[model samples]
Target chain A: MAFRASVVRLNRAIVYTQNGDPAQVLRALTYKPLPPPAPETVNIKYLLAPINPSDVNVVQGVYPAKPSLTSLVDGQPDVFVGGNEGLAEVTHVGSGVTDLVKGDWVVMTKAQAGTWSSSRNVGVLDVLKLPRVEGLTEVHGATMTVNPPSAYNMLNDYVALEKDEWVVQNGANSAVGQAVIQIAASRGFKTLNLVRKRSDIDELTRKLKDLGATEVLTYDDLNDRNLTQRIVKEWTGGKGIRLGLNCVSGPDTTSMARLLGQDAYLVSYGAMSKQPLALPTGLFIFKNLTSVGFWQSRWYKQKTRSDKENLFKTLATLIGHGKASPEHEIVTIPAEDSDEVAGQKVREIFAKIAEGQYGKKVLLKIAGSE
Target chain B: MAFRASVVRLNRAIVYTQNGDPAQVLRALTYKPLPPPAPETVNIKYLLAPINPSDVNVVQGVYPAKPSLTSLVDGQPDVFVGGNEGLAEVTHVGSGVTDLVKGDWVVMTKAQAGTWSSSRNVGVLDVLKLPRVEGLTEVHGATMTVNPPSAYNMLNDYVALEKDEWVVQNGANSAVGQAVIQIAASRGFKTLNLVRKRSDIDELTRKLKDLGATEVLTYDDLNDRNLTQRIVKEWTGGKGIRLGLNCVSGPDTTSMARLLGQDAYLVSYGAMSKQPLALPTGLFIFKNLTSVGFWQSRWYKQKTRSDKENLFKTLATLIGHGKASPEHEIVTIPAEDSDEVAGQKVREIFAKIAEGQYGKKVLLKIAGSE
Candidate 1:
């Protein structure tokens, strides 16, 4: 590789002028070169960015956290940049950027910095440098901060799991759910995974097992009391499922609650079902089971810089060893494409995601100029 | 009042051999006087016993804590006692009974000791002596352990409500709800109470206000967004509702949850609606609210003897100062009536209770032969 000149370059960004459906409100804009990073800041060229459910919610104006829109970008006044999670390459460093260098790779530690762009400037404090370990793909680094940490923290934060202890979760095939199984397996904890019934039930079960799930069942299986009893008996030898991760609420939440052991906790993170959580009164009154909500964004806000960097270092090591990695589908956006063409392509993918046409997460790869 | 003979008395006992409807399974039996108090026991003449909702649940075999049905009573074979709360006068004390005397007033501290009888013997450990306060009544002593402690602990245990801080509770006219209002008021804590609509709404509101309620509203008020916002603002003065006491689950719980402040807690102790608790995803995700169950019986089981006595002492002081008292209705059960006649009357009152015929709690006064 030749040494690339540290020169100014035109920036391309995806911006949303108002809160509405992404296809209707989102636009692509070309702007003047981003300013050389401030003394305490570092310039970065985004390598890849993934579309998250929360990111979609932010664009639609339903999420609580929002990016501040101002007349910061030249030519496009009062516009907000689009994405929250992505991987980037350090293109230039400011005078005060001590820890990061031109060749280093980084990912956002905090959210709402607008990563859906070809190039941007961010304070060194906003990004955590990823270790340059072999086999650590840009796809893995792009997606690591949100889903993996959520799974790792949910499993280890509330309850301590001894080897062979059980952890149960609904939405077992979701991105975070897959990460939970693999992480728990690596830690010697067993998982009882629940998923919605699909036509490819056997294939899905096999795939989850390959990812380290100890057992798999559908929502229909949860209703069969005798089957649940038999599974609990054989899987735990009568010990209770100590930690329950609930992302799908409604009757799904109540069914998962029934399988909790004494003093167990069911942490609710996402409500993909858009249904309210229903819990039997006896569960809380007699069994002492607790229902709590978890938001990775909130947890991210509270964590310290060193804490976040340490988590990333650990996750990177896992990815290096192939012990923790999310399944993803990559979509490459060409560097020379017009703003309108790029934005249209992005909107099409968002529409497919809304219709559940894609099972794996979709990542947008920005083909940088060499 | 005449000085009655403190002599051996024929004891009439009410017992149930199996769990079923209180009216169908309960029977009265005239038995020999309970054996003279054992070395560590005291013989007591029952003064008053109140029928509680949990008491009904106990008789119907739906409660978690069940009295062991053994052939303990002389002629009644393998039967469980019919009551759980009462006030009594110490008629006799055994040689080893050091703390209690012949006329001391006491009440059952631990649950499931037969309380619905004319006379009985119990170990001193089973009862906590009521303070000899001038204003203390049999009704207050009979119902101290469950509701008052439940209200006090729920407000104090989960979250700390400082002076002038606000606490909200549904079922504001129920025994526990009324107790919560009085206790919170005595501590300088403000309360926003929610109750069901009734024909006598204003009358019930006035009654709760007399018990120190800051404000009272019907369930309909919860549905009006502007009304809820205005009440929350005025009651809290922008401070959050830190503690929410919920006894009625279902939509009642969801409505209460909506009014909680940031990081607030909703403690569910009873489900009068018999409906499951339903909570919206946003409340948990954004407000950081939590839902937990509270069972006074469970708390009582965990507390030490001094812990129980100290609580009762504090409660007695409150009652003596006219700060705490539960509303009650008293019924006299004549000691000389036939087993058939007395059982018939007991069944009639229970039927009334089942029909929600009375607002005040019913207390049976066994007029033992003098």
Candidate 2:
């Protein structure tokens, strides 16, 4: 059965032929046919995918999940899938399939289902039926599963942010941070957002404020020795901040740690700088600060079906009512070339993400125009 | 006013005078008169004092709290008091004293009260009335406040341990660890205790077991690579350990982090090894582990008086009934000591503690036979 599909046939990928340099690698490929889905799998017609930091980490071989190599034409497996999550429409259900039907929009709910392909078969348990929101595009739905859920879970699970309480999160302009700002604001909680100083600082601050941030400050502002003390005085009326969410680690974490009130929690979901978290002993001992880490994928796996359902319902309602929406930059790729060109495009987008250039999510539009 | 007291008037205490050398600082001191109690104070005659690891830490200048250097004579402090807590007899009441009367035995409830004194003035709030326990001597009553209260609060403040559930703690032979074992045992919860290997490993294991430890293993035994896997298999019945209490950091903490189940908490109260805790990212992300640091003094200050009173009552009952007792090595020091000499003795004792040489607490006996 020769079906049209984009393929990385052999031992070749946008190779980084050199170390410690970004310019050495460009997209190139050898050739192979796609493997058929297993008995309990369903074939998905790729709809949309997003380029995330984890994808970049995988390309650089620094991620925890590594791709296995297989021999191609020259007994060398040079091709591997690159994306972690994406939205897809079920095209064919295998013999053992019971729940999913054709035309259903689904999201990869577990590890190992790469969504960069045009058509790929995955185990039924690995995919979740995404709740339909009217007028919600595949691009928005694709990027929704990871960051929005991360923001939602961290806020709900760790500490219940009361209507009057405040939440402070770094990377305010990133997808997750933006979701946090919107969700918190809609729930009647205030947000103290932090972001790096960009050329359009005023505009960026205004945009975040419009999205529900009470106060927005640049990283440079936090460098002041008395910044923590000042922020606490102004925002909390001398009560001190209760919850701090950090994706950027390093000495910045130390500053965040100092700002938290007694018995407060700081949850770090990502280490963008790849630096060790050097926290002071005084904060932990004197203030009773709790430094915790959060990974959305792991958290989702541990949650019960009812919990996931509740989250889906809440998030879907928010999206349906236009209370929260992801800011995404969508790049359309023909469905026929999704597998080969989409992965390379994702790697390129991820490079920009790693450089901290993108203001919103960089998405791949896998399906043809509706 | 000539008050009979044993005093070290000069800089000659159990002086090690050398690093890595044995404790050769035990010495006698002359007698001196103490000043009269202030208007808002009560004069207490020393009854009993316990030597704690923190006291040892203080003596070595490694403790967070440093005594003020105001009582010095000539170039050095002449007479000083050195003991964190002890049972004392109220010998005289100050002019404004209303709640306390002479002949009542009281315990110094505050952190700074030096109990190794024949007669010293302390505020009413700094003392607690000691209940009459038939076999509870001044020695046993003297050491009651800190450890038992610490253990009680740490266990209760975090996750409430249910019957048949497991609680794990390192440094099982320490005062706090023993208290946890006994308290948990009484509550019908099992404990997995860890300890460093000693000459009397078997005997120590037996003693801890007798004190309510379900399983006691030396550090070497726990250092196994598969120790966490084995612990999960045996203790949790493959469910995973719930609560972890850490006093020793470094790799010991790393082990505890690995053994915990999802959403489990690892609360560290002490750093006996003086090494920073190194936690792996996997534990933080996959296991949903929370790392928290605890300081008893901070917690005590933060808690309400009623809470403290309840904890004290429960602890007093436990001590009175002989259900909980801290092991100690008594070292009699004169009540009257020159500030420099007394401080020097404390420093020496604390240095030995930091070296991990002393298996038992070094106590100070004042105004009485050793």
Candidate 3:
């Protein structure tokens, strides 16, 4: 079986001979064909891929993991294939492969580049079986591989919360926070959500509440020290909060730490503010507080094969039962378009995400079927 | 059998009349007597009491728990009693008390005042049997009730550290940190100790190392970013740290958080700096870090009776085995001296402590030993 792939012939990716900023950094161009899948590799017909903030970071050379430069296409010296993971259909299985058949939906389970292309070959182990669910579409599966799992593992691994216990998280409107709200709610736990105050905060709050948030609050609510204290006291019945999730660190992180009960856990995952976290020592000494960091990539890599299998099974069950659904915006790009055009679209969408303009994930449609 | 006690009568505690503080607050006068112990109370012959920071906070009307005002004394008003808990010999058991016997060494296991006096009547539940360990003095026993237990619980409760695992803590020169160093070492765990750069830091580091510190360093060492990273890499074998104990919050907390591995726990228990904790959110999201607060008093209050008893037994055994000892400075106050003289001595010692001239705990020795 043969399919055309927008392979990186050289290191050059999304290049323009005429250079400027974003317009020049990501130059769309055509690339030469790549070799077929080798033994133990499966050629995937890329269906859709999500334009994530980390993807933008990767292009900017700030991401922790960089794609290997050796895999660049022959002619494109400055360009490299960039997408981390995406949903696809099995086009051709290598001689050694037995698990996946043609037309089976799969997603990259590990760090794999060239996901922005129409087709790419990846190791069998790097691909996860995407069980077909009635309501979940290809776009949903494309976007489901990262943020949802991050939220799921963080809430489940840190603290074994009771049904009535509360989980307070900043960035409540983000995809991960939203997933957390839903997953926590489904597990019989309550969520106290914190998001930036917008003109449509009430509507946003309503949306989140409908998604299983017990309480939706703005950063303004957390900033007013007295009101924050009062709200925390009332909500926690003076027992104080048990778990505080923070992505927006700064004064807000310190405030979250203060509002927690004795021995409460504060888990931080992102620094949207790019500011250092300032927490009071009293929170540590007098409160017996524990602060820890979480990285999904590292956590997933560290998990035993059995644990990973169990997690995937659990996630599959949730998706199959409609308890967990991806909230995504799908943008279909034609397979005939140059690789540069597709890269530009992903970059534009990611820029909006970086600016906090986009609320939902942006999925790039690659396979014509999707 | 009634024994003479230099009790601070209600409404007539010694007070500082001026903001100049020490000299002004030294006056002590007589008032009416306190009521006898209530039912289920045990009258204790106060053997020794240790002056603690909380006691000073209380005298300044800054402590959280405020004592009630009463006119049972000679018409004086607004008087406050000092002392939290102390080692006492059971002198008289009230009607409902069955666990305590006369001549047994006991310590107040709960919040109480009036330990400065020769005797105090407290609830039987609020007192614990102090096992007779050879060479354990009453002064040492009084000091043992808080810091040692706090260190023990903080280290044991937060991380399930293995024998070869390392525990890092700041304020290594502090009583609690020192205790942690010893306890962790005795339990076959290594300690990466961080202390302020004092004039006697070398001596202090040596002493701490003798007590169980694997490596003793100063904040200056942590200030060099590259050096800190290298040290962390070497200490953890590039795997990352497991537990970080912080009492000094602020920018220091951020450093501590950064040094931790994924899913590592940072426990805070004290704030000598009186500064808020500032940390980056990357530690939370990317590192899977957890920050939690710890309060020994609150923890003690919440434990079951049997658990409390077991802790005491374990602590006593540790002390008996010479694994732990309270460093103290005993200051004897004659019972025959006027209340004013006794008050002056306390004020002088407290002044020295405030001035940072004292290296060990101040133990008040009340005259009239059994």
Candidate 4:
């Protein structure tokens, strides 16, 4: 038998050599492809990746976890890969790998695994093989790991919120907030969503309601204390707001906190408003409220592999039942693009994010599986 | 046997007919004596009562729980009693009473049972008879139910701090703070006490150290980041400050909250600053810290009779070992004086409290027990 022939393919990646503005600090490189996977390793073809706000922060070097910079990729400056969340297909697998095979779909398990590349080789444990559902799209699977899990854990983990119990959340238009609404509705829990007022308030409210939000209100509605009290009284049946999810801090945080019942928990996952959480002293003393932080990344680090898989399966079942779906738009990236062209495209997308031009999650489609 | 024919002795109590400043709203009144104890009732002769801040708030009608206004006390306006905590001796028991005789010592178990009186007729269940200890002075026993139990529960209930672990607290000079320092020391837990800067910083530090405080620093010392970090590192041996007791709020709250390790709890029992607790957003988000409130009165309502006795016994054991004692000054109220003269004396003591002239706890010695 003749020996197998080897073929060389050029791999391109977006990276940053130093932390700064993404437009100024990020670059693209075309380099030699990975050699054959060693034992316990797999080579993957990048499919779909989401350009999350946190990904931008990672490029700016402001994120808590940073990607590893390396000199392994020749003809390029030592750089760290730019994205944290993405979908990939295993194209090759080493002999010792037992959990995955060629053609299996996977996503990066460990954060900062450099998913911004067209293709890469990683340890089998570095990626989690996802269970395929008949109608599960790559966009849903690509973005599912972060925001959906965050919302899911926040709802189930904190207080023992029974059926029909109410949860309140601000930033209700964000991806995580929308997922919380749908998931809570699926679990027989009601959600009170607070969104910032805008020209399209009516449109946004309708959109969130369509996603199964129990009630949607503007920040102005929160100031109408009598109205808020009436609504809460009627909706919760005097049980009081049990759980609060705060991403937009400042006075908004205090308002939501005030609405909570005795011993209620306010789990904050993000502070998008750049404002500090101003909690009133009386709330802490009189209401006996508890304010805490939740980081899905930290939780991920603590959970076992089967634990994660079970959670993913639970999410998949919800999606399969048509109870949950992420609103998103895909921006396709050419697989054979030049270094400069790809870097330019990445910058433009980030600029749009900064400008708040995109209302839904913007995902990157590289190998075109979506 | 001679029945000891009944004598009508006048009962005097401090009362509040309206809610406002303590000086203007409170009054002293002499009223009709108890006819006799009904079955399941007992008559208690008051010994000592401590003036707590909550008592003042209750009289002002600002507190959540309020005492019932009534015409039960003859010759007095429709009003409520002026105190919440005190030590008393059982003077008479009803036919159904099995737990006590005339000499058993007890304290009010329910709040707003009109404790600040020379004597009271109540259901036997309204007071909990304490197990007498040889050296358990009226001063310690009268004050034990509030500050000591508060410090005890806040230490043991919230966090499972192991030996050699650390707790940080502001208001180290307050009654609860002093109790915490002593109790934690007895349990082999170290404390980092934060007090306000004063002209006698050295003297106050020495006094706290004498009470088994691991380290005592002024609020200015908290601002000295290097010194604070070094002290925490050395005292905790890197376990980090796991529990924080906050009474004084405002900026001091944020500083103490910042000192805690990951997933630690800051329990706010009082806001002595009268300013709201101002917590930074990052502490909640990054450190996973929790801010909550502790109300001993509420906790008392939830606990069983045995639960309270166990805690009291634990505290008495500590006190018996000279491990804990409340820093206090005794103010005598003449037992044989007329109502008007006793009222004048009560007003004088309250004036001293308002003027901040007394540094330690002020206990009313109505019966000269201590």
Candidate 5:
């Protein structure tokens, strides 16, 4: 902390000149450090930025969100820096910026605001101040802004689920899915978690049950008509599921939709299968089903600053108590690494993530490659 | 009208003992007429009952709304009577019935309440008394209960559509589609209607446009990528459609969903193609699209009697002033025909309906084969 005030640091960022294969397009750029915060702006040095799946899509030009592009990099005309969610330390507060100051921890409120950078000047509104974080880990802090809030909003926004009420979701092994399981479980809500069929089915089932899941079954289990019927008939007493969170879409999503009773809602946040949701119109007609989508970026835009802060406070409390745990793998980038090596490291990590091999979220523990 | 109060006519109903092909399973039963309505009930003779596609489904036992089964039929132990929507003339009102009287006009509020029967006793709450019927046709009186209200509700329930705002719907030639066109037109809203590619598509387009459609295109238009994109970019100037009414589900339904903008709602009332709605998860997540189903039967159950009556009155007035018209084929059954002939006639009409030859709605004009 004392070194930051005494010495100036060069800012290095993983920026892309064009959208395509992440490994081929992404590169590290060394840029001049900030002078001081402009009015209403605060300079933040990103402590940790998680490489999410959607971040890959943003680089591939397939994602809906666009990254903030800048020409400030010393040799680049314009480049988009990767990473959407990050934990940062405020280094210098801009004139008239009272909400944030040096040494304060904050999270990005802006979507794709180029959090992959070491440090940048940003309007105070673009970041939300994290409450005292004595007990929370940096990984929890970095991953907190995206997946947890999404899980919280998906459960609370669509349906008012009562205690012990059941929620069915696919991609149950995904980051957001785990958060949903923990959050719903904490609310006394039961979850029917569906995942892809794997060899370690029993182990995955046990893992989810430990997270307070009432039932854990692979998508293959839904193929048996009798078993599917029995699930609603015996487990829910035919009340059926009212809320379905889907990240994997295809015929299996159709089956998941079938488990929903009349007047139910299916909220889709991702398409892990990259397949369309082939749902029978009868679910929407006969069963009065509704299929909707949820985007964390959209939620952030629509909600008030206080709404987000309150959510952050609540989730931090839960995470502090070890009630909600998000599995993350941290990859460190030392401050003195060469530009090519550091950027290559980021590109390779993203390539592995895009291929789904990184199974858990990967957070970059980076200050800069100075 | 004079004979209704004086004569005690025998009752006859088209009943299905079991579900299967309507041609093979439907039978006409000549049951004893009502012996004065049993407290708060009223005796009504159906003037006309619309043999909807759903009615054919009802006989096939594929429809969602179950037909009311009665065991009082002289020969059958228990039988399900066909027909859902009807306009009946009230006769021999029971002692406790004050809202209805002999010779009054009424429509069934109950879904699949055995309206195919010539005369039967129904609870007062099961029927809504028509305000006045002097200027309305029997077809309008009969068809009004289902499609118009469905069209009205689908437009109003999901989106707050303003005048000149566009609504997109497939099944442009359907009875409900025509109603949607007229009702939307009456409200100063425009419609982009899509229909199947048939030999008479041009003629169908002309007909729909005559009924107040802004644009009528064959589903094949959606297959053209440039045209579909143009519909949103050119016609709407990227304001994109906010409400889409889908009946034909499949890939085409997916294209219709794509036409919708962010925060749009796709209200599906039926699935004529019997195919699933294959939608990309991105539409819901990035675009904030919501796909929901609309069932007129569910609407009947959820809304108050007066809510229905208000809609009925509004539609009836519209029908009275020639603002809206539903095309229907009235097939009459002579009062003295044999039960075998009458039953066979119904089965044949339904077979034709199921085969889609009856492009227009088929209304059964029956006092019964007494």
Candidate 6:
């Protein structure tokens, strides 16, 4: 089988023939590599791809975005390569492409654009050229495309939050949450963060504070209404929080939302609790609260290419300036590993991500071991 | 005591010196009438004021907007007059008043402006002169300031609903609900209304249907998702409702919101259920559902006087052309009613409104009987 694959130089991609438990359905498949890019296309070598929580849901067939089925993996009639976000290095540029060339680093502009493959032929339109960055790490580049921009856009999109205005958010230990803390702090805004209570609560609070959080509390802190009220009084001086970011829903989100003032907005991007968001109807009517949502994928789909480029440029500049940096972990698949071993590793990492037990965002480095 | 009270031909105004149940805290107090209106003011005789549910909450001191404390009732050091909306006649215009003359119909321009009074000394800024609306009844004129405009604005505010597009709403038998049906029908939009199941379901459904609801559903219908699916398929050709008007929340509204399509909005104007709003977090993230609020009092506070006058004119025109008429019942306080009798009547009507047992809006005719 290896000798047959070598006829065109084989490529390995994470594949799922059907949707279900990622462990049962996902595998690494070897297939003949792309012959060459057609005009206005490029062959991209995926350097790193992050295992986002939403990506796990996609594999489970529970997410709204469905991955496009591809027949390029191991001659399968139907296969879906996983991963929505990653950074890539252009290996070959097809004729008629002017902007990107070999050795240029870029990111995928399409939603669920199958980024888990070691290498693939991609159209120029599907790739976004990245601005040069100083001291950029592989982890930041791979994960920045989703979480950092998600935080940045959410901070700017809903409310023109003013200086000294603080944002309240739950799931403050997530990658996006850290980015929110850093970005908000750099913009002169304060962040009130919430994470689940854990045995290592003090350590997590210290880490979040190091990321620029003004205050880091736990879901357990919500029970003390007086404590939250004091935050409003001592921190905000009677002015309430104007924006709230939610990922973990249910009682935690409900409690976080209470800190919002009149005409405030609560933007939801994830449902980590797997439970629904609930709030008092009086909040909407009396406080004039607005509950909305943000999906980075949707933003990518709607925004112009330049708009997306600008977003990345902004985030990169912030990173270079040391104002913000995404916190993540890299899980590399050794080059000598067999397809079965690689696939098993992918499933294990994803399970950890789905359970949210992994300390930081986990990015898959499939190109080879460092 | 009666002879002494006639010293200035005493005027009666609602007085709630402390906050509690309307029955316990509210009273009609006869105090010395104002000598005259100050400059740029008028002595207006309140013709009619409706007992709104929020007013009951206001008397109970539960609503966000606080009634201004005044000492004009029974010489009380602190008193809050009961109504938020009503129609009045300019009985005696102040010296500097030019736009308003004797007998010109007007509505209060200020929120919680002590509308539940037989007569009050008010500045011209506190009142808005009415447009000459032909065939306008006291019910439509008195009640139009809050509910009709609420329905009208709510219908137009959130979504730019196209013709044939459907709007879903709970509390379909409410005064605002009827107005929503009529206004939407006039504008070529469709309405899917929800009300609680009642012994007279057919009668209520027929009434709302006559007001131009495309379909009238009860909270019970929400149990059968298939029935709602059928409505989407058969009635709307699979296009889901884009706007949901929620006055009741909790599970009933959660089900109602499920009928909404992607990128839909749920605007809450009232909380009749006295419960919190709750929904699946996935809806906000996946479907991009937005939950906001509509408070007519807030709208009135922000909009320019002409902007407000235009809204009233639009509704008045609709009423004049037989496009709509506010559904209301008159509870007249006879000219000879003692303060005790009048106060008791107001409390009784408010109790019914609070319980949602009143068939139609109850407009208090306090100036005199026919």
Q: Highest TM-score: give the candidate number.
A: 5
Local lDDT at B111 for model 3: 64
Better of 3 and 5 by TM-score: 5
Which CAPRI category fits model 1? Answer: medium
By lDDT, who's the top model here?
A: 5
Residue pairs in clash, model 5: none
Tens digit per residue, CA lDDT, model 2, A1-370? 2223354322222333322222124343433333556678887766677777676666676666654432333554444554677888886677778878778888877754555545666788878777777856676578767888888888888887778788888878878898888788878888888888789999989988888889998777777858778878876888777899988776666666667887788888876656545555456665677878888777667787667767866876665655456667877654345335744664566567767788766776544312
What does the lDDT come to for candidate 5?
A: 0.85
All candidates in order of DockQ, best leading: 5, 6, 1, 4, 3, 2
Candidate 1 regions off by >4 Å? Answer: A1-3, A70-72, A95-98, A232-239, A367-370, B1-6, B36-41, B91-102, B233-240, B367-370
DockQ of each: 0.69, 0.27, 0.53, 0.63, 0.89, 0.78
In model 4, the runs with Cα more than 4 Å from the true position are A1-7, A69-71, A74-78, A323-327, A355-357, A366-370, B1-8, B35-41, B69-71, B74-78, B95-101, B229-239, B323-327, B366-370
Q: Report the backbone clash tally of model 3.
A: 72
RMSD of each: 2.6, 9.3, 5.8, 3.7, 2.2, 3.9
Model 4 chain A worst lDDT run, 10 consecutive residues: A1-10
Please write out the lDDT profile of model 1 over residues B1-370, one tens digit for every residue. 2325565456666778888888788877666666668899998988888898888889999998888664545654677877888999898789988889989999887788778888888889999899978787778888877888888889888997789888889999988898899888999998889999889999989988899999898887889988778767876776568888888898877877777887888888988899998999777777777778898878888899998888888888776676556767898888789878887888888889999998888998766565
Tens digit of per-residue lDDT, candidate 2, span B128-200: 7776666676666788777777777778777876888988899888888998898888778889898998899
Candidates, ranked, lDDT: 5, 1, 6, 4, 3, 2
Q: Where in model 6 is the C-alpha error above 4 Å?
A: A1-8, A73-76, A321-329, A334-341, A344-360, A368-370, B1-9, B73-78, B323-327, B338-358, B368-370
Model 3's DockQ?
A: 0.53
- Candidate ranking under TM-score, highest first, comes to 5, 1, 6, 4, 3, 2
The models' CA-based lDDT, in order, is 0.83, 0.68, 0.71, 0.81, 0.85, 0.83
Instruction: Give the 10-residue window scoring lowest on summed lDDT in candidate 4 chain B.
Output: B1-10
Query: Candidate 2: deviation at residue B19, Å?
Result: 25
lDDT (tens digit, per residue) of candidate 6 on B1-370 = 0123234455777778888998677887777666667889998788889887788888888788888888784544878888989998877777989989887889887889888887788889878887768888776778878888889999988899998899999988888888899899999998989999989999988878887899888999988989989877877788778899999888899899879888899999877787788898878887889999898988988899889878878888886665556667888776578889988887787677767787667787665322
True contacts kept of 4: 0.68
Q: In lDDT terms, how accurate is model 6?
A: 0.83
